[model samples]
Target: MNKRIFLSAPHMGGNELNYIQEAFDANYIAPVGRNIDEFEKQIKEYTGAKYALAVSSGTAAIHLALRVLGIKDGDEVMASTFTFIGSVAPILYERCTPFFIDSDTASWNLDPNLLEEELSQRAATGKKQPKALIVTHLYGQCADIVRIQNICEHYGVHLIEDAAESLGATLNAQHTGTFGKLGIYSFNGNKIITTSGGGMLVSDDEALLSYARHLSTQARDDAPHYEHNEYGYNYRMSNITAGIGRGQMEVLSERIKRRREIFNLYQKELNIIEGLSFMPELPSSVGNRWLTTILLPVHLSPEKIRVTLEKENIESRPLWKPMHAQPLFRDAKGCINGTSDTFFKKGICLPSSSSMNNDDIQRILSLLKPLLNC
Candidate 1:
């Protein structure tokens, strides 16, 4: 059998070892260390956000963001149903209900139309405005932020951009994660860039960052001795992982470039396929192209193509299972128009790691072209 081709996987930069060595040499093995500080600084600088906090995972960042938004039991938060479960699970952590909205086919993110409809319906019931609105930049393509932000503002809901897969993506020159009140980034192993495992919470408001830092560090109060004024969580990223992030950050731009190149290769090679289409990045959206996704036509289901690719020793996966479709969220309220559901049935994520050489890409194209022909 040929070497097993994978979906997106960690592509490391050589400089990561230096940061790890520095952390070991300085004995900064804990979460509170120089590496963490540097990583936060890098995020703030890159995103132009006033402040940032390094956290254990993207879900933790969203939980922290939801807490900062003051969501409580029974309060409602609006989110995209067509996102990774991690994006909406944090709302459940706060004991808040997630009012899911369907995705817009153009960007494969949240549909503003569905969002407006839900907001209007919720308001007509005379309830308090939603505690927050969580919009995701799914697959690194920036959502329609301008309209989403306008809607959130009109409705007085805090906007949390779950940009886990879109660290470098932009919308009309503005960064994806920076459009909302708070934004989160993930550095999971399969993400465009990886810190081995880490995430960030960023915002223009310094106080939010301060509070997030406090909450992440066990909410210990100011005292020389062990003390706490409120409950806390051990969600801060470790110095070692931050070291990996620092190294990964150094080559983030290069990784994005490579991922985009991979997308172009697929697009060029697979352009002739009648029933297949690559998800497009709109004019105003600058997708990091995190994972190259293709949507099979009605007759050619994504799963069918996935199995075909797998049999050829190449791996592919369906798009994220919309959160509302999951059993855990079966009871959650959602405004659906079959957009996300259709995407799920048709979309497949192809191999998009930056480490793929030209030969690897050719092999993927080779396997896919014949399958499309069949």
Candidate 2:
């Protein structure tokens, strides 16, 4: 069998083990350690946020963000429909109602026009607007965040960016996760940079992050005795994983660059093929290009291509199914215009790991090109 081609495998920097060894030498195996502190520091420095909290996973970060924003108990929270479940799962955890917004052809992220219209309609009717909007930078690409942020501000809605797939992505000159009230980034095994598993919540508000830090550590009161004024999750990131993150941070820019190169290679190779087009980055933005996605022709299905690649031990996947289309969200409210649903049906994510080489891409194209042509 041919070697396996993963969608987005972890590509480690050379210094990961050195940091891990330092953590071990310090005997800081617990959550509260130098590694965790340094990891959070690195995130803040990189993302230009005033504060950051390293947590167990991206979902935990989102949950803490919602809690800090005081959005709960049936409060309406708006979100981008064309994203992974982790991006919006915390809304349910907080018992907040989610009103999903569809993507647009311009950025393949949330549609700002739809958002403006919805918020305007709500205001006109004297209807209660959503308390927050969780917008994802889909596939490491920038959402139209600046416009979205402006709209959210106009409507008195908090914007929480889901930059899990876009650690190094930028819109104009600003990083993605920093555009909103609170943003979260994932360092899962398959991300551009991996800490095995971890996440970071960033914000300009120091008090909010400090409160989230308390909540992440179980919301224990700072007393001599183990006392709790309120409940919170044990969502702290470990020193070991943070050690990995510290090293990952060292090479994040390089990883993003290589990923973009791979994306360019895919575009150069596949553009000539009829009815297939690569995902676009806005003229004013630069994406990490985490996974080079393509929208196939109407005659070709993403699933069929995914299955065919699986036969050759090459990994591929369909685009995210719109949240409103999920059975779990059948009763949820949404301002849908079929954009996300269409992308979901026709899009496929190709293997675009930073570790890939020209030969590896050729292997994929060798199989993929034939399928598309046929």
Candidate 3:
């Protein structure tokens, strides 16, 4: 049997070992260490953010962001139903309601029009204002931030960007994670880069970053002995993991370039197939193409091609099951645009690992062409 191709797997740069060695040599194995500081610094510098806090996972970052924004029970947070569950789960964690919005066809992120409708309706109910807007940049594609931000501001809501899969993506040269009041980046195993298991919360607000850092580390108050003024969580990233993040940062640009190259190759090879359309980047957006996706025509389902790829040991997946469609979130209030449902039925995520070479591309194409009847 051949090596199974993954949709997206971690690619490491050689510099990782040096950072790990430094961690060991310095005996800074705990979550708080020079490595963690350096990693946070690097993220801030790279993303042009004023502050950052490393965390255990992207979900934790979202939770912390919500907590910092003071999202409490009964507060309604506006979020995209077309995104991964992780992006909206934290709202539920806080016992807040998620007022879901559908995606715009262009970015596959939240639709500003639907957002306005929801907000206006919610306001008409004479209830509390939506606390925050959680928008995801799905598959490294930037959301229509200029419009989304405008809507958020108009509604007096906080903007939190779930940029876990889009660390290197940009819009007019501004990085994805920097577009909101708070944003998150994941360093999971299948992401463009990995800290093995870690994430970061970024923001321009110094106080929010400081509060996130405090809350992540158990919210210990200033004192000589163990102390706490408020609730806390064990969400800080370990030094070892941050070491890996530091190393991954060194090759971030290269990985983004490789990802885009793979997308180009797939687009060039597969675009000719009938009823198949490659997901495109917005003209003003620079996407990393975290996972190359295709929108299959209605007659031909994406699941069929996914099954075909799986049979050949080449992994493929359908696009994220819209949060609203999930049984867990079925009760959540959401406005309909049909775009997310349309994407769910037709979109397929293809093998898009940065490590994939020309030969790998040929193998994937071989499998896909036959299924596509091309």
Error of 3 at 374 (Å): 1.1
lDDT of 1 by residue, 1-374 (tens): 98888898888899888998999999988988888999888888888888899999999999999887778798988898989988988888888888888988788888888888777877999866777889999899989899999999999989999999999999888888899999999998889888878899999988888899899989989999969878979999999999999999899999999999999988888877787888878787789999999888676767777888799788889998898888998898778888888888888999888899989999888777766773
**Top candidate by TM-score:** 2
Ranking by TM-score: 2, 3, 1
Number of residue pairs clashing in candidate 1, backbone atoms closer than 3 angstroms, sequence gap of 3 or more or interchain: 0
TM-score of each: 0.97, 0.99, 0.97
User: Relative to the true structure, how large is the alpha-carbon lDDT of every model?
Assistant: 0.88, 0.93, 0.89
Error of 3 at 112 (Å): 1.0
**Highest lDDT, which number?**
2
- Which residue pairs clash within candidate 1? none
In model 2, what is the error at residue 282, expressed in angstroms? 1.3
Q: Could you give me the TM-score of model 1 versus the true structure?
A: 0.97
lDDT of 2 by residue, 1-374 (tens): 98899999999889989888988999988898999999989988888999999999998999999999999999999999999999999999999899999999999999999999999999999999999999999999999999999999998999999999999899887999999999999999999999999999999998999999999999999888969989999999999999999999999999999999999988888899888888888889999998899999889989889999899999999999999999989999999999989999999999999999999999998988888783
Q: Mind sharing the TM-score for model 2?
A: 0.99
